[model samples]
Target: MKIKLVAEHIYNQEFSIERALNWILNSMTSEFCMRFFHEWLEIAESGTQQLTTPSWKEIIELKEKSFSKFNFRFETNSKDKQF
Candidate 1:
């Protein structure tokens, strides 16, 4: 499931990274997300000139953090399990 978390910085006009972090952490538990991260890692590690132009660190870290925070389980008999 996708979730959106905006900052509630109505008082001092400050944003909360924690809120975003929490939302991201929640999204990381999916198998699809995990696969995406794996692909992202591959691209990041390629060391090609084109891939180095944009910073992939933030994207990788955020998604990786989400995946790291939760554990996924599959009930498989043949090979892959159904959700």
Candidate 2:
């Protein structure tokens, strides 16, 4: 999935896999990720929405809600690191 690949790419390291997974999980549900990407794409397509990336604080509060909702766990190795 897009989330997994992006997360791994950004957070790749032996000790950072869990952090990567957690961040990916956090981002998928974060308002900053969802609404921002949606609106950003819309704007990119039509040139009508705000031009700047929104603040992370816009979704800071949603972190807890997002975190509590997902419980996925898995093992990863360098073999799974294929781009």
Candidate 3:
């Protein structure tokens, strides 16, 4: 869900949609998608994650292996969402 929204927002243009999907897909932590993303890119001159086809198995695997951390900032009235 998050990926879809973020990808759409980032790549609102049809021309850039593929690029946006690839970025999010590569950002994922799955052995399958991680490797496959690269392979797909290698085959195609440009990269796209095939977002139309959702792979549940790969998503679960990515979620399980998702240990990488990213720093993000948030604004809140009570407190700043600090890292």
Candidate 4:
């Protein structure tokens, strides 16, 4: 799946990043936002970039690391067993 699709899917889960983004980064100064956007755009456009597909363990670790306050459980359904 595409990176955007994966992000959307994850965002649709209980832990919403939209609210977090708005409260954290979006509330920052215009110069900070511009710099952040420019950096993100540059990394996205960089042809040499390569992202490895994350394993379930890595995903869980990331979730735990980023949102330690929330309890997130990941269940593997039949459709997701392949991962």
Candidate 5:
């Protein structure tokens, strides 16, 4: 629910995704935070439209930082198993 709105804002360039990430990190304080990132990625890759290169790069960098900072392990049901 909240994640969907944030992802929509990201796609629309209404605010910095990094700012949203920071807010989630500071406020969520639970495994639930991962859902926000996952939902963003899912929406970005859903093929309704292509992300601009800069937006894509930003997402990748933020993902790496979040995973490393929190020691997150990504699991996907998709056979390709890619993030």
Candidate 6:
């Protein structure tokens, strides 16, 4: 995603970051958004570089941690189990 943005000369374009971030925030579920906000706050308070130029591994780790509280059911055996 970052590569595509950079390749298209969209990285530093005016309001690009805000637009992209808004899109991402809008795409997320409320639960996921809350989790992401808490994690981001922790990183901000900790003065961590993980929020900037994160490596793929760091990104994956962050994602996993953010989702750790949720229990996902992939099977559609019941009507209520539908995503």
State which candidate has the highest TM-score. Answer: 6
Task: Please list the C-alpha lDDT of all candidates, in the order they appear.
Answer: 0.46, 0.54, 0.47, 0.44, 0.52, 0.51
Give the poorly placed runs of model 3, Cα more than 4 Å off: 12-15, 30-83
Winner on TM-score between 1 and 4 is 1
lDDT of 3: 0.47
Q: How would you encode candidate 5's per-residue C-alpha lDDT over 1-83 as one tens digit per residue?
A: 76556455544554344564665566555544575567566656754576443367666665554452343232333353222
TM-score, one value per model: 0.25, 0.29, 0.23, 0.24, 0.24, 0.36
Clashing pairs in 1: none
- Model 5 residue 26 CA deviation (Å) reads 2.4
lDDT of 4 by residue, 2-71 (tens): 3345445554553344553443343344545465555545444552455545456754554444432322
lDDT measured at residue 47 in model 1 versus the true structure, 0 to 100: 40
Q: State model 5's lDDT.
A: 0.52
User: Per-residue CA lDDT of candidate 1, range 1-83, in tens?
Assistant: 21212223211333244444554455554655776667666666774745564356756564655444444332223332211
Off by over 4 Å in 1: 1-29, 48-51, 54-83
Stretches of model 5 off by over 4 angstroms after superposition? 9-13, 30-83
List the lowest-lDDT window of 10 residues for candidate 2: 61-70
RMSD of 4: 17.2
Model 2 C-alpha lDDT per residue in residues 1-83, reported as the tens digit of each score: 86476646664554466676676666666744566566555545554355554356644543433333444555555665633
Best by lDDT, which number?
2
- Error of model 3, residue 80, in angstroms: 36
Task: Compare candidates 3 and 5 on lDDT and give the better one.
Answer: 5
Clashes of each: 0, 0, 0, 0, 0, 0
Model 2 collision count: 0
The parts of candidate 4 lying over 4 Å away from their true place are: 1-28, 47-83
